[model samples]
Target: MHIYSSHVLVCSGTSCTSKKSPELIKKLEEGIKRKKLDEKIQVITTSCFGLCAEGPIVVVYPEGAIYSNVTLNDIDEIINEHLVKGRIVKRLLSGNNEGNNSYESADFFKKQVRIALRNCGVINPEIIEEYIAYDGYQALGKVLTTMTPEQVIDKVLDSGLRGRGGAGFPTGRKWLFAANAKGDKKYVCCNADEGDPGAFMDRSILEGDPHSIIEAMAIAAYGIGSDQGYIYVRAEYPIAVKRLNIAIDQAKELGLLGDKIFGTDFSFNLELRLGAGAFVCGEETALMTSIEGKRGEPRPRPPFPANKGLFQKPTILNNVETLSNIPIIILKGADWFKTIGTKKSPGTKVFAIGGKINNTGLVEIPMGTTLREVIYDIGGGIPNGKKFKAAQTGGPSGGCIPTEHLDVPIEYDTLIELGSMMGSGGLIIMDEDNCMVDIAKFFLEFSVDESCGKCPPCRIGTKRMYGILKRITEGKGEEGDIETLEELAETIQAAALCGLGKTSPNPVLSTLRYFRHEYEEHIVNKKCSAGVCKELLDYIIIPNDCMGCTKCIKVCPTKAITGKIKEPHIIDQEECIKCGACLEACPFGAIIRK
Candidate 1:
């Protein structure tokens, strides 16, 4: 075995890779060789460090000194000053201040408690040996060697792990149902079709820690008494799919995946199933249908997947994030896992925080962490000093959380109580500039488009709701439109065939529940309060503020702003396209949308 005096861990996660961390890696290697420290020092590329705002991160082990925002130029300095001389590089170190103590006191990592993300930035995901070094397959070994299927299910049941994939169903109970179902040919399915917008928590896990999911699936297969497993990953995530394939190949080569037993009687095999980018397939039945080479549509449930699943046999399905937690729960013991979060919702949740936030990336926090903590402390509050208006959780099937609920604990029940859900953990922050009605319409449009046309409630009902939202946003809303929306939302919620239809009204319903005043303004006053819906807005020139720079006139596509240089500009309302190019192009505070 090759032994090194020190190890250089560089982040090769998607965010860092986009920032050229791979090139940075090459530079470090050349620098190490040039300094004649190649034998003594080792460089390893790993996964996300979570502090993505400071990307291209490097951490030196045996000293645990973390460096942020590293470039090719800084590589030589790190190699010469730190690797050879055994000194810390001051400039590259993280934290608010600049010293050894400062790096340790960094605010970025101080409050975080890594459980699901523990192995993310620590090991090479493609290499099984490195995974083994980090005790990757230890859980599988323990389960296969000692525990029975019933015993394994019991352990998970005691762990208090609910499914992280939107619905928050108890994972152990799901497994138990499949285990009890008497079927000669049972299977395990992994829901990797992460269709939610801005939700890449599952994708990151697949990219950075593919082996974890693979191992967890093996554990689940054993628990569910299944010999075959299929991972239904979306085709959109090429990187994640590539890494997942690599991990599966590596695991199979190591005798961990294919008809292999780790030398036990248990034998399980896994395969990849690609999705054709249908958002509706995020639902289990729809995902199964897609995997079976059929149109992605949800079937009626009662004989749920546990009773009659893949190939019409008993099957257990768990999402990527839920599977990611399985090995850890089994390895550490259920009691150990249960101690982390709230009693009902134990364990950590990975949230993809994006849209109008300062720190836009994946975050793993305990289930009970407050929205204020996630938005203010971790997300760095709303960007550019804008007041936080609301947050949209659960993508199209979820609701908007108003500012009043910022302090609410972010568990499954809490969010549902507030008219949102823990739907796949896509927490999108919205600032004061966002219009509530427009936001609802935007999500409804997505829901309408993604509806599989299988159920009338989801297909036609969402379309009708979206049309109403469109009319309201366009200043053509009637006084009865609000009541109509409410009636339609309730009808859809009660009558929809699957979860996709049932939860499709969430955005409209929640926005109406919380921000009805905005709707009233758009309908009764014929004005969009946030000035987002273009049809209800008219861009006018504020003559007092206009500098007459003619920049807006030159940039306007419709020649709306007509004025000579050095004089106040005037907007020709008849020619105005309402594209807001003038508003965006105006350097001065000249253009006002009213």
Candidate 2:
């Protein structure tokens, strides 16, 4: 292997790809070839660079010169100035205009501790050699050649790593249960079925470092004495699925995944299972059932997957984010891994921060990082000068953390204590414009639609809760509706069979816990404080502020606005529809929602 003079890493993550990073890559390659520098310059397509806001991003190493929002037209200048002449592109570089000079100076990358996402923007995911060059499969080699199955389990136990898949269960304990199960045939499963609304941590890891998950699965197979493994990924993630297939084929070709792996007696093989976009299938039992070619539905516990799973054999399932960290834990040693994070939660967590935030992208920080840091510092604070209202973490199954709990350390126990579980690490920030009652209703509606309906508590309880929330948002809520919603939430939580049904009430429960005042305003005052619930809001024209602009009339879909030039507008109350088009179109800010 020869070292190249320079490496140009272009982010091919979904966010950057949407911004035409692929075309930028092509232009870079063509320009390098046109300059007769292909031999010296290596252009690579890597995973997300974390700063998705500034993409299509290109980082040239080993100088670490960061270019934000690069285009195909800029490729020539970059090649002529930076790549060939070895000068930095000051205009394209990220960070403030004054102080900092390099990529590290950017506030986004400075605060982030990329553990699960370390290799995301650094290496070419499609190339197996690059993965190996970065100490990728070295953990599997170490585990296969030296460490016994018991030793592997003990190391994970000592590391204090819990599942990143939201349950926060000790990973080593789950592995031990499967290893101890009395069965002739056992299996290792990777749950890549990430269905959380705002979450892309799993998909990014899979797309950027599929080899990590593959290698981790192999090590898990060795630890649990399983000869077969399956990765149940959602079909929505076509790029991740495609790359995972490539990584698996490459692994098999290199004699890393087939019979007599690395000259050891252990034989492990992996297969792909595509999910039909069922959110309920994210649950372990439902995922196993889907893998077994059956309708995805959660079954009763006690006969957990460790005892009876996937063709009635003992099975261990870990999500993609959870598996991605396995290789590092093994290679770095348990004690070394344990020293980085909180005492109990010993690893980094990847969060998909979206909604009302300035910097919306995938962020991986240490486990004990505060919500304030994630929301204010890392997320660049809320957008549009809007006050921070609340943050919905952990997806539909997770709960909301209000502004009061912003100081909470984002650990598994701390979030759970505040009525939110770390479900796949999706932290959606809400601003003052967002209505808490409507937000809860929106998540409950999602839960109701995704429920498998196999269990009565989840099916009926979710429907009842959603109905109560709907009535509240639609201005039909009664005084006792809040009490009724709480009751239904409790029932669904206690009686539901699987994780999906049990945690379905999280959105409602958490909102009620923190933003009960919002619910009270909806039910008692018949008003939406955020002015989001259209049914409870009335659009009025302020004559003093109105410049008699007819712009609102032209844009109204319902033709509800009646006004002439140099005259105040009048909205037909019955035909208004509460669309707020007038409110948006008014130049003088005359239209107001009350």
Best prediction by lDDT? 2
Score candidate 2 by TM-score against the native: 0.83
**Candidate 2: RMSD to truth:** 12.3
lDDT: worst 10-residue window of model 1: 102-111
Question: lDDT by residue for model 2 over 1-594, one digit each (tens)?
Answer: 978989999999999999999999899999999999999889999999799999999999989999998988899999999988899989998888676677556777777877789899889999999999999899999999999999999999889889999989999999999999999999999999999898999999999999999999999999999999999999999999999999999999999899999899999999999999999898999999999999998888879999999899999999888888899999999988888879988888999999999999988888889999998888899888999988999899999998899998889999999999998989899999999889988898998899899999988889988888898899998988888888888888899998889899999889999989999999999999898998999898887787886999998899988878989888887888988777788888899889
Give the per-residue lDDT digits (tens) of candidate 1, residues 1-594: 989999999999999999999998899998889888899889999999898999989999899999999988898888888888889998888778556665325554555667777788778888888988988999999999999989999999999899999999999999999999999999999999998888998888888889998899899989988999999999999998998889888888888987757888788888999998989898999888888899888999978999899889999899999998988888899998988889999999999999999988778888888999988888888878999999999999899998899898889999999999999989999988899999999999999999999888888999999999999888899999999999999999999999989999999889989999999999999888786888888899999998889999899998777788889989888888899888889898788888
Q: lDDT of all predictions, in order shown?
A: 0.90, 0.91
Supply the global lDDT for candidate 2.
Answer: 0.91
Provide TM-scores for the models. 0.82, 0.83
- Name the regions of candidate 2 deviating beyond 4 angstroms: 1-104, 549-567
Best by TM-score: 2
User: Would you list the clashing residue pairs of candidate 1?
Assistant: none
